[model samples]
Structure formats: C-alpha cells, structure tokens
Target: MAEHANIPAGKGRSNAAILVACVAFVAGMVGMSFAAVPLYRMFCQVTGYNGTTQRVEQVSSVILDRTMRVTFDANVAPGLMWNFKPVEREVMPKIGETVKVHFTATNHSSEPKKGQAVFNVTPMEAAAYFNKIECFCFTDIELKPGETLDMPVVFFIDPEIVNTVETKDIGTITLSYTFYPQEETKPVAVLPAGKADGNQKL
Candidate 1:
C-alpha cells in the first residue's frame, strides 16, 4: 500500500514540472514579441542620434558646424524619395566664426514625407574635436505633397577645434539629409513658449 501511494505522488510531481516549463516558454515568447518595437527604436536612436530619428518632441535643431569640407556632397538615399542640397558646397568657417547653411529639402513624393539627417566628419578621426551649436535635424518637419522648404542651420566651428591636435588637419565637413516616411510615428510636441509654429519660424 505504501509503495502504491508513493508512485502516484511521484508522477504528480513530474507532471507539475512539465507544466511549469511549458508556461515559462510561452511567457518568454510573448515578452519578446512585445519588446520588438522598443528594441528597434533603441538601435536607431543610438546609431542615428538624429533628433528627428529619435522622434523627440521639440523644434528639431539642425546639429552641424562649419569647420571643414572634406569630400562634401549630399544625396538622397533610395528609400527617402526627397532632395538634400546645400546652398553652398564648400564653406570656410574661421576659428570662432559662426555660419549658416541653407539646406533646401524638397519632397518628391505625392504623399506626406518625413526624414532625419546627419553630418559626419570624415576620417572618424576628428570626431572628438568637432563642435556643432545649432541644427534643424533636431526637429521634425511635415510637408504637404510636393512641398519644398528652406531649412536654415546655424553653426560655428569651435575655436577649440582649430587648436585641437587631431582636427586641425581636417579641411571639410559635409552636411547631408535623407528623408523617409516615419514608422511607429511619435509626435513631437510643440512647446508653449517655443519659437513660432513651423511656418512662422520658417
């Protein structure tokens, strides 16, 4: 009689373990599926660092500086279907001098277009010395079909950059933008005391 009772109790324990294991697997899968959106977002934000890409609310400041033009040119990527061109291809910003860039972005698509842009200082060498004060890429721009906007970005080459050992050799920095339709659109809230609406400021 004792042995019979022990066998049934042991089987019951084995069944409980199997049920727990199955529940754990299902929970893990559910958790992972829900995490996909936030995970992809984290990857884009860190890699891109564009306020527009980050989808933060505020007037996106164009983050760039007029330091050097090292192989400078602008082009639209395949997906963006937009235009990115600088008013001036090559610019000279003296130490402590501030300059403005007129980046004309035109939406070529028939639907509302959006995108984020970034400027890279080549050689991956002078990144430490680069300093950018103001930019439009920090904000989001919404365009009606076939609309063109004159976006202004003001930046200055930091006086320290010229003094820095590594960046002094840099002669050019290229500023460019790429526009694409936003996925998982996050609204950038307008501040109450912020500059006028997008139209008013432009």
Candidate 2:
C-alpha cells in the first residue's frame, strides 16, 4: 500500500519541475524580445546596414577633388502638427569636405509639442561612407505654439568612397529625415521670444 501511494507523489513532483522550467524559458524569451530592438538599432548604426548612416566625432581630414550632389528630404509623421523642411534642396561638396545644412521646423498646433527625428541615406551602398559630425537628429526637439526653429546638420563624405567598388560610381546621395511625435518629457531649452532661430543646439 505504501509503495503504491508513492507513485502518484513522484509523478506530481516531475510535473511541477516541468512547469517551472517552461515558465523560466518563456520569461527568458520575453526578455530577449524586449532587448532586440535597441540592440538591432545599434548594430545597424555601426555597420550602416539598411541605409543607416554613420556618426563621427571629428570631420574627415582628407578632401578629394571629386564632388557629389547630396539632396535633402524631410517628413513629419501623422499626429505631429508641425511644418518641417530642409532649408536647402541640394548641395555639391567635394569628398571629405564638411558641409553644414539647415532644416526648419514650426509648431502649427495650439499646444507645445515634442518630436524625434530619424534619418537615413539612400543609394544604400553610400550610407557606409556618409558620416555626420553633428546633427539635430541626435536628440528630441520641443517647440512652443507658433514657434519656428532652425536645426543644423554637419556631415562629410568619406574620400575612400571613390575607392570602394560598391560606391565609387555613385553620383548622388539622398539624406532623408522623418519626425515622429514623442510623448512629453523634460523640456528642451528654447530660444528667447521674438527670435526665430538661434545657433544653440536644441
């Protein structure tokens, strides 16, 4: 009778162990899914995969006689009532020459709003050689009602681009930016009243 009674208890213990293992496995997968996005973004930024551009601290030191036409494009995601556009349509800069371009954003809505910009370079192959030294896209932007702000981007094309078979023949590169509405957060510094633009980084 005692031996028979122990059988059910042993089976229960086995089932409980399996249940715990399954729960742990599910938890691990959930954690990985949460981490995957930022990890993948970092990977893309470093490798310039999928049209992602590279970020650099210093401007390129080498300048070539060759020049490339770089065009700018801007967009605003739905729900953000803002007017965003590149100040310049296109620029022709020599390889390795640092260029500064401006973009303007105006908040047309009645309330203050926040936005974050994402950027990419087309001719996907050329993204690997296009580098940004300083850009407004690096952080979130805030604008009060009826306020207009001018943002700047500083970048350069790598001279080695001409040596790379994949990008050597590329004549033009297009850089595009899209702004999406962001939830309200810590306020960003704003320009003094009556000032439409300022040199300060937003």
**Candidate 1 deviant stretches above 4 angstroms:** 1-72, 184-202
Q: Which stretches of candidate 2 lie over 4 Å from their true place?
A: 1-10, 185-202
TM-score of 2: 0.85
Error of 1 at 146 (Å): 1.4
Clash number for candidate 2: 0
**Model 2, span 1-202: residue lDDT tens:** 4554456878999999999999999999999999999999888789889888999999888999989999999999999999999999999999999999999999999999999999999999999899998898999999999999999999999998999889999999999999999995565876676565555454
Quality of model 1 by C-alpha lDDT: 0.59
Model 1, total clashes: 16
Among all candidates shown, the one with the greatest lDDT: 2
Give the Å error, residue 199, model 2: 52
Error of 1 at 29 (Å): 14
Each model's C-alpha lDDT? 0.59, 0.94
